[model samples]
Target chain A: MKVFLKLALFYGIINVFIEESLFNYPEYFPKTKYDFSKNNLSKTKIELGRMLFYDPILSIDSTISCESCHSPYNAFSHTDHRLSHGINDKIGKRNAPPLFNLAWKSSFMRDGAVNHLDMQSLVPITDSLEMGNSLDNLLYKLKKNQKYITMFYEAFGDSTINLDRVLKSISQFELTLISKNSKYDRFRLGEDHFSDQEIRGYELFKKNCSNCHKEPMFTNYKFENNFLDINQVLLDSGRFSITKNSDDFMSFEVPSLRNLSYTYPYMHDGRFSNLFEVLKHYSGPKFNSVSLTEKETIDIISFLLTLNDKEFILNPENKFPVNKLLK
Target chain B: MSNKFEKFAATCGFFFKYFISFLFIFFTYNLFPQENIEFQATFNNEATKLNKNYSIRKYHFNIKKLKFYVSNISYYNRKNDEIFTDEKVYLVDLNNPKSLKIKSQINKKSQLYSFDLGLDSVINVSGSLGGALDPIEGMYWAWQSGYINFKIEWESNMCSNDNNQFIFHLGGYKKPYYNKRTVLVKKRHIHRLIFNLNKFLKKINCDRQMIMSPSLKGENISNLIVKSFEFKK
Candidate 1:
């Protein structure tokens, strides 16, 4: 019994470090949907993953990284370009969506193609228009790097690198991108006050927008056709390409409104450049249900600005761990 | 002193007997090796020649690219008990004939056994485990988080499209579109499972060439592909 107690004590101490690297959200936020049991967290793995996220070694030409498309600032999304450019100056079809509070998400991609966060990296990594690197080749390249060798050892308890570990570690780092620190979050926690315009906008948001872009997480994560006319040039059929369901035609995943201030050039196609334009587009006759007068639209835009978590964007923890990167 | 000598001798006799028996079993075990059967997959009785045009039910086609996955390979004994074996997922590329061979280290062997054509729903959803199932193989569907179990790209005059292309991306881990199929084989220790693509394409009307999703059509073709693999006699 004493030996068993000693063993239990040993495990208890080990679990503390493992469990500490978890979703560090405020109490006001809803329960996360990420299943922690499948992929357990550890500080070493998350840090390694953060390093991997910032490192261009994951790319074929060592030019682009996960951070290239999903920048640490700008809410981990590219705001300058309407469409994400890849290696050798190749432009991709869709805009790279902002990534945060991903633990609560059920599906990924603007089209809801990737179901798991761990599996999400594979798409961009393998896409010829994007990274243009095979998982085998990427693994081979990372395996050759001594820095990654040490990091993989520290993260996985062995120097050997595999796809599962690499992907899961990336997922771990992405899972820590919790953004429950905005003025809206403070209001929920009773730590701050909102302006009357912000309050009115919040009320309007609850009535009209909250159905698709649900509360707290700010997304229901389901594909819906907002009746955007198909781009005759691109001929991108959105969710219809994946599901082949006629109802899914011209539909897109309801993007979270969090950090809209940083992640500009909005919509799946990056059509709208600002919140007011987005509001005007949504308020059109196609979406008569979201009828908003000019003042209400501005008020709503003001409320959206409150969703931008500056702390999250500038957080040092989410950036590359190494001071100097390999050229 | 005499009794002590007798005891020592008795102990020596016992040790020698056991040592001789151990050596006998060890040498015999080494002499006769357990079966480690390697299956070499071929398409229509040919791998290298498959890039050429072939006819199936009066429909002629030439394989531009042909690749598929075979997983969960194991051997079975006469008693119907599964021989414990290392689980391996093999990505077979008919274009590269060298990639067709799959070796399995198995115990409790028999001549007759079956294997999975593609990863089951479990491995399909479990995320990357490297090797054949790795996303690098181009077999994985990033959009839907599953694998394209079987793929065949060909140019056939039977296809009505201008390109005369017949592309089949058979996949789906979900119900009603589950694409994994099992094939039972016998008659040889080193199995030669023939994947007759002609039989598969014939099931689907040549006019309807493209199948890139999990649907009733894909499921029907996948079933036909399973039946198409002939065990070499």
Candidate 2:
């Protein structure tokens, strides 16, 4: 009896170690691009990250964390607004993108301005129209909060606030925002069946859009000239602005189609309100590139609807950590 | 009553033994040295020389910040023999070559030291903003995906009709634009790989200061810099 108890205790310890080190995602998804080896996730870090995500301490007026624009209910994206609004109702240049499965993205922002996930938050926190707060000032503010001090200590093994710890904590939380248990995922797992319409849509998507919006994760992770006409006022040149290459003129990073239900106001500019508008744009003469076919367009739209993962948006664990924040 | 007391004593003794063993193991792990080393690069302009004719400027470039990961850095001497191996952090000052410092954060761990040298396994070449942060400064180009790795830029006021700006952004990572080459330095007895910046400038044949950014082409003259350096003792 004593031997059995000893064996069980050993097993429990080993299991805990394994669980802490590994993140479990659906097998269909490709390997994550975000280097977890640099940040390394922990329970404490995730909790601290969640708190920071909801806290407005990151902004100048203390009105925005990452969650202000990218809310969980809307699949971590802003709703209705074409351009993202920040502190003092300042309008940003681009749309607030939906945040999910970021571990797979090699680059961030619609333009891929930032290369590493760790440095992505700095752009928003420092952008004049966005948070309008410096890293040093934000650190000073976080230092005053006793709860944050303790939380930071627990997450990073040191309470003395720094940009590295702050960014890492937020990254830890964002990395956990993995959305994979969609209807499509269930069908892939052999545990559930897709409706005839969804199945037909999936076939159409593979033929028309699968080259760019590849399956499993639904993104080729490449920049493409989707043939979007230059908006007259914005005149945004997309990837060309970053690279200064004529070839990259108007090419934008291909966004993931997952959670399309909640993350409406689609595209880099957020010009389209619903899926139908986006489909209409694709069906127009401008998008009549050699790449897409008319029949394939409708089927792709059907497959996009199936990409919505209801369980992810409603997950209580990912919601505003009200109790922790209140404390 | 005596038998029950003895059984309780045995259980208590067993618990104490396991607890002591666990403490020993924990302490042993914590006692070891675990120090992390980091590298930083610095750039400096020594002599700011401005031209009278076209208002073109020249500056002597020096290392501004020297940062690197020396934990896995290996050094090979002239004879290609391994001399030293351990975790060490080094900060190299390009202007003051002799002022090298080695400090130990953790006593039991290896000491971190830096050197002031131009070219080693890693070199810092400034041409593009993206190239400055690359592990190897060899890849510097705007058109291609990867770094050009090595190139030079120079400003000349003597070459053009109105003394127009001269620019030579060399080193191509792709074929057809391929300009990188290895030169054998017989004097140093080391295979000194020289990026022939002069050769590239000759090919372009326009002795004009080349501004790196396309937007700044006519407004400002581009200055390209290269340093002759090696690992020091």
Local distance difference test values of all predictions, in order: 0.79, 0.61
lDDT tens string, model 2, A189-259?
A: 99888777677778767766789988888889899988888888888889988667789899999998899
Stretches of model 2 off by over 4 angstroms after superposition: A1-22, A287-300, B1-76, B79-233
All candidates' TM-scores?
0.80, 0.64
| CAPRI-style quality class for the chain A–B interface of candidate 1 | acceptable
The per-prediction tally of clashing pairs is 0, 34
Candidate 2's iRMSD: 10.1
Question: What would the per-residue lDDT of candidate 2 be over residues B1-233, giving only the tens digit for each residue?
Answer: 99999999999999999999999877765674333322112222122122212221242222122221112233334554433443442332222333223332332322322222122222212211222233223222222223332223334433546644443333332223333322212222122122222322333345334433223222121122223222212
How would you encode candidate 1's per-residue C-alpha lDDT over A81-166 as one tens digit per residue? 78888989998988889989998876788887877788999888877888888778888998998888998998888998888789
The chain B TM-scores of all candidates, as shown, are 0.75, 0.29
